[model samples]
Target chain A: MPVSIIRPIDIWFAEQIFPHEQRFHAAALRISGSRDEAEELVQEAFARLFELEGWAAIEDPRAYVVRMLRHIAIERLRRRRIVDFRQFADTDHLTLADDAPDQHRIAAGRERLRRASDLIAKLPERCRTVFVRRRIQGESSQEIARDLGISQSTYEKRLARAVELLSRSWQGDEDALPAAAGPANTSRRSGSR
Target chain B: MSIFNEKQRRKRRIAREAATWLARHDSGTIDEERFHAWRGATPEHAIAFARALAVWREAQSKADADTYHLLQSRFTRRRAAAAIGGMGMAGLLTAGAFTSRAYAWDSSHSGVGECKRLILPDGSRAMLNTDSEMQWRFSDDERSLWIVRGEVGLELVRGIPARIHGLDRMASLSHGRFNVRLEGAAMDVTVLSGKASAAPVSAPVVMPGQPALIPIVIASPSEGLLLSAVAPSVRKASPQHLAATIAWQQGEIVFDNEPLQTAVREYNRYLAGKIVIADPDLTGIPVGGRFTSTDPADFLSALELGLGVRATPSNGGYVLTR
Candidate 1:
């Protein structure tokens, strides 16, 4: 198809899909955050679907938009994971993947995604709950906290703390809070200054 | 590049490259070879790999936690209700009462469809609704007040509090009261009073033994006979009515057997917007409910049961009618 004739097709698809885009944009922000990155994710997702050469071939356009948007959110989060991984910067290597890392590293290139879930199962009550709600159900912190009878900041702190603990566990460091053999039986919370 | 600057520069270049790639891929373009090449490039490339992986894991966990907790909440509620059965749930008024002495809490007028309150530092209270304004100032010797426009209710705490202690202390006003509707029509006054004086209104200064309605038309400024006649016999509020009046102090608005128009006007006091009754038949129907007043649904529910009116979402708010 010539580029000149194909441009109107973009407009048609955009109009047919505007409501879902708006809803997805709103739902994405509510799930993720009110940051520029989230806005970028929504815009890029819609733009990509609209701009794709195969844009005319979408089956169930709503689901297609959702799938693209969700992928963008997941990928964007992975690229920005550094400062969030601070507390768990030193866990043992051998224990890392075997220690149920799929439950831990959910979706990434080289890390053991297997241990991620197991690591979550080992988290303290608050952090684990916050993690499940935000990442799984795609609920906003406000919604989670409202249901849990707590503040949104408290939920954020829980997630941050949970991430920090997971990083330490993956690196096999022994000081993150653990009830059972935390960090290779290292004294839990002993590193707190 | 030198080893010191070499790794630093490489890391920065790769991070920029990686961020750009992620941004691009987020637009749904899968650049497979370039993404793979970016992953294999350097030790700092490994660092980027680790960072992205960790973030992805945590994001997934948060998603997990949200669902886990929501399911828990849903189950907990269902279980409790199944065990105990549904009853009218009144959240306890556990908040402690405070003698909050603000210099003046938010002095403002009621607009065409607005209602507000004025809080005096000495613990007295006033309600302002529907195109009204009021102001107050406390002095070493007296409590001075002005109702600039609109209607207000004054429940004198000084006298009630003074009587409790039985002290000979006095809270008198230098200038008793200033009745001001001078800019517009005329001033109106009713002394639900300890002692109140009205300006531009008549002489023999009205007292609390009787109700007084005085229209101050001090025409020509010099010839002013404030015609103050007895405001007809009236009975004090029964216990139920007193309870109704004071109910709002506890963040509730109580209306029992009040006409729908009257009830809607009361609900409109604590709410940001108006709840209008368009139908005259609906207005006369009695409404009875104990509502937190901040909730729009409470009003709707009350109207639904008490008056057989339906609430429909209109624009940004609700409209009620039969």
Candidate 2:
């Protein structure tokens, strides 16, 4: 809890562990089922790690931090006792829980979500279908291929195409234009004053 | 394929392979040793694998209810089959064309203190006032525009049969210039040139100055159409009111003996920090000016000097009291 006391060693430790931060957060999200909880759990774990004596001597720090965060998440989950496994099973994935603070991060996340949605909207119809089936509907590759009357390899290719387009969009490539440049900027640029 | 296309295809193939490996890894089906070996095979492989993993994780985590609805609406099973049965490449080309055209005609928005002018595909022009958003749809047979929020001035072609939809009513124009303003559920249509027939989407046109409930509909493909019923009264726009209504387009706020409350609201639309009237009695004080829309400080000075009101800074904005 003494995390407010900043020190050079803490800064060094945070920098050392920065690369693994996302992976640790992803693992924590898997266990916590909430992005805010996962972020808090990871920050708590980092603070705890910094408080430990001889922190410099720890090997495989990424694994150590991940393990600590997972333990914290599991303990919190047990304490809450409100974990309904049925909610996880439901594919609706409603993000009703408010995650306040870090407005910049929330804005960036929303922008990413908007961009991804726009890219998905522009996908070739067949490719989009395969992607939705595999990712959103949680359908298996073999089942989708059989249902679509396409070879398994072809289905996989379509899925890959969808992924490729999404990746390009996230990377802000020309093929998948950014949402800000979508209708407004394009028209402004092409139309005469 | 050209060399550039060939190179892109090769990169996509690698990315796809990496994506497949990451998917398997996430599902607990991949051989860890082989996966590690494949990732370490080359620096490019590791980079692709990392990017693919990030994309997959983000896709999984961010697919909330809104995204689910969008995907479901667009990628239904029957439509998927039809798209595949038709020429796949042609379907993709047409989809791309539609998307670009929609972009060109979809929406125009202006930030605070900023005015935007847009030239429609048919050579007509529209100027949007500050803090406004409008959606437009243009086709070979008809030209339709919806002022979803804020104010817009249109200079239509001679005979385009254009229709402008506002909050509580829709105006049909055959060849004229006009402006539409929507505040909350109230719509005010000003005819600058020629003429337009106004009617509620769900009801017949009512006499001017009579209160009537009118339903407004905004057409959207994914969500169908959004309909809102609002009680609004229409007015035959006079020259005096029309100029004041669109003064912001000329970078000024022309308040002609309006209430302080109305002038403050109009000023807030074009400025960043808002002006708050702390006393209820101050709302009825008459205000008239031709100040620049971007300068609220000048307005405050005028209020303090001419109206015998005191202006004090409060909560990141100025509060006025008499």
Candidate 3:
């Protein structure tokens, strides 16, 4: 087929594949649902097939993309960075976690997250990314692993390590929550005890 | 530093080390046992690793701003530097060196960075640099070029017929971005908009945008249809032009007030000539004008005149004596 005809088909296939990209992250999240890892798996899937020459040349580009992403994510789990935004149920909402209906407060919190993000940005290239996908974005271990070409097991351990040191590294810049400190209530109890 | 500051510094130091070790381990330098031993050294070690991971994640969030910004910046820097040093055009001009094609046509074209030029069935000449792949599409009305991978220079003459689809009409087509349909080999790039559209092997008209593979015919064009065809193989952007593709044709690289250091990248493209800007402050100096690609002297002169900097030829390439 001439290239002209292939493009529209690609656009169409891209939409279909997007869901699969989402599902894969959810699957990876089952093991370690860190936002970073989930997105890593999602991104790796997309990158693996982003430049695929012909959508029809392969029988199932989606499956191929998924499998390739899974394999790559598994490989990257040992490393850091697989590749996209891992979508949780409410990712598009852009609201804060608070029960209050105050948009201004939510916006303020987002600003704080941004500041916290700036701190995380100081990390080295790959690991900093793993930190983002695993911590900031709440991606699962498998997804971050998939994105970074590492294993899921390593993703969990590494992410736990990231969560352990947020207070000192970030110092007083508070907005984003530290890696995985349970809940505010749990923290208060621990602090009091 | 205060006591809190000192304590915080010690903690961060421990965390940063642990993070570096984990990153290294991920790189497969250290084994799991070693990783665990380090982990057990102190609770601070674990915290440090976690902190480092936080830093690492922040870098990624920034990347979400643009997936290829870091990579593109490097390419841009190199391209700019090459243009500034005037070596890309210079080497190509003096050597008239054709960045060649590895068409599996000849043995010599198959090297790491070989240059090969191919005479299209149309009179246009295509020069492929090392590690580049291009396919010539010879159809009746539209003579198309599929630069499947890497970069190639296309020179168009008057008679070559490369039918162009305008950027406005692009909503209907999906061939490529930056399609330049020129007349023959050196007709000058005029159209670089829209995408490449043509049939694939068969029945894949709906699948474009993604890199495409089709069971295309291998034979050179049949003789009879040659005369009736008028194709403009390359399509360049018309309104606001991009310089990358056509820079190969002009022996003079034109930078419109680009950073002096950035322009040196254009020079590095053709020759092993490297330009080091010793003064980091001078790195941001704006540069403009057309310099002959063959010599760094002209480029150095531009820097001296434009930015009052002295250029020193290094052991390998050229360096701006900071």
Candidate 1 to truth, TM = 0.28
After superposing candidate 3, which stretches have Cα over 4 Å from the reference? A1-193, B1-117, B129-150, B155-245
Per-residue error (Å), model 1, residue B114? 9.3
Candidate 1 lDDT over residue span B214-322, tens digit each: 5322211111111112221112222233334444434456654455676676677555656776777777554444566566675686456434678887765668878
Q: Which lDDT tens digits does candidate 3 get at residues A149-193?
A: 877656645553454344344432222233335564454433110
Query: For candidate 2, lDDT tens digit of each residue in A1-193?
Result: 0111212233334233543455666666766777656656766776676568866445446667766765676566567768766534331222212222221332334455565566677778898898777776667777888999998667766776777666555433445433444556665433211
Worst 10 residues of 2 chain B by lDDT: B219-228
Using Cα atoms, each model's DockQ against the true complex is 0.04, 0.08, 0.03
Docking class of 1: incorrect
Residue lDDT tens for model 1, A56-144:
44544555665665566656657775533321222112122222221111122112233456667888988778766665565666788
Cα displacement (Å) at residue A17, model 1: 57
Per lDDT, the best of the predicted structures is 2
Report, for every candidate in turn, its global Cα lDDT versus the true structure.
0.44, 0.59, 0.43
Worst 10 residues of 2 chain A by lDDT: A94-103
